[model samples]
Structures are given as structure tokens and as C-alpha cells.
Target: MFGRDWTEKDQSVIEHHDYSYIVYKSFLKYLYTGVISLPMQELLELLDLAIVYCETKLERCCIQEIKRGISIQNIDFLRSIADKHKKEDLKIFCLCLESRNS
Candidate 1:
């Protein structure tokens, strides 16, 4: 850990290989502005970032965006994501969507 009088040697660079540059940039923008608008795939990537960083608000926002774009084709995939992330709201929402469509 760097002390109060940090120097260039104390600087650190974190890397995220799984996320695209645009997705990472949008995440930083969202952190400052509390706003994000991106395609569903990018939103999913952002959701992963949020989960990794424990950003519950951003995670909720991403889930809302995913819900808006959800369809029969993507329900399973999204549900799996919800399950993987332990997002009960999203899992319940996916279930409701499935039931409604049935």
C-alpha cells in the first residue's frame, strides 16, 4: 500500500481483460454521472463490472435495461446471468416474463 505522500512508483494500473474499452469507459462515466445508455450486450458487460465492484445501484440499472430488452430468445440467457449473479429480482422477473408469454 502506498503512503500519503504517493509517488509515481506508488501508482497502480488495474486491468480488466473481459470488458471492452467502451464498456469500461461507460462504467466510469456512470460512476460519476449516474447515467448509462448502451446496447444490451454492453449493458450486460457493465452489469458484470458492477457485480465485480459491488456497485448495487449500477447492477440494478443494468438489470432494468436488460429487462427492457428481454425477449423469448434471450430470457434463458439472462436468467442464467441472474442466477450466476444471485440477483433474485432478475430471476423473478425472468420467471414472470416466461409465465406471461406462456
Candidate 2:
């Protein structure tokens, strides 16, 4: 581990967060603290954090939130997230979910 303390001193995430940072931090935590509290957001970043980390569960949770409109406004981003998680079959499901609301 780096000499620097890995404590979560910063605000949970980057103000302009990206998929890479999310995955990198998730890796760091699993490697260090043995805890993985996924970030909660009013708006999920369009960048697919799970694709980068290859964490299907997290991707699912985030996309679900987006479809619920409790998160960001980026269908393409959600689609990519779904595709990355080997959930391409879910694209129709998600699209259907999205359409029902609108």
C-alpha cells in the first residue's frame, strides 16, 4: 500500500467523476478495507463505472436507478453499462422499463 493513508477523506466521489475513478476506488477498497459501499447518487454519471470495473451488480443497481429517474439522464450510458455487464439481453427489458414510465 502507498505510504499515504487511504482513508476516505474526500467527498465520496469526484465532483466530475468518471467510470475509471469509480472502479479504481472500488479496487482499492477491496484490496485494503474489505468493504465496498457503492456510491449513491442523485445523478449517475454517464460514464459506465461498472464496465471499467467489470462489476455487473453495481452496474445493474446504477442502471435501475437511472431508469427509475432517481439518477442521471443518459440512455446510451445506461445501455453501455448494461451491455458491459453481459446483460445485453436486458436492453429490451430496460427499454421496456423506460418506456412504461414515459
Candidate 3:
């Protein structure tokens, strides 16, 4: 954000203290190579970062990975995350999986 009225416009160095170094590095790698490699926890954080940065392609990739790792044990957790993030596709997928399992 180097444009007018941006927070980082007048700053020389921008800092993002939210994510860990590893997670941020992984996100940068994905940005450059279009490949994502991270554990489930970090992957979820990366999804949040993708959404924040408006990286739709990366966001979709994270969603796909999350779907692949979904299980009955974690369906409720995933549903809650989907609801929190307003990810309708993920919410619907969780609902379908729950219905099938039920």
C-alpha cells in the first residue's frame, strides 16, 4: 500500500506481526511458485492470509487442501471456521459431508 492515504505509504519498512515467519515465508513461496506446502494448522493460517490479501487462487487452493483433509472428527470445527469466515462453499461442503455421515 504505497499509494495515497495508505498506512504504509510513508513507511520505509512494513511489518506484519500477525503470522509466524515460517507461515509468511510459505505464503511468499506460494505466491512465486503457485505451490503450497504446509501443515494443517499453518495451512489454515495461510488461508486467512490469502483472504486478507485477496489472493483468490491461493484461497481456492487452501480450501481444496482443507477439503482433502476433512474428516468426521473435525467436521464441526471446519463448519465453524467456514461460518466464521463466511465461506459458503466450505460450509456447504461440510454440511453435505455431515449429512452423508449422519
Q: Pick the TM-score winner.
A: 3
Candidate 1 lDDT (Cα, whole model)?
A: 0.91
Predicted candidate 2 versus true structure: per-residue lDDT over 1-102, tens digit per residue: 223675445446534344446556664564576444554342244225554657666556555555554223656556665676556655666677568678
**Per-residue CA lDDT of candidate 1, range 38-57, in tens?**
99889999999999889989
lDDT of 3: 0.91
- The lDDT of each candidate is 0.91, 0.53, 0.91
Q: What's each prediction's clash count?
A: 0, 0, 0
Q: Which residue pairs of candidate 1 clash?
A: none
Off by over 4 Å in 1: 1-15
Candidate 2's TM-score reads 0.36
- lDDT (Cα, tens digit) per residue for candidate 3, span 1-102: 899899899999899899988889999999889988888889889999989999999999999999998999888998898998899999999999999999
Residue range with the least summed lDDT across 10 consecutive positions in model 2: 39-48
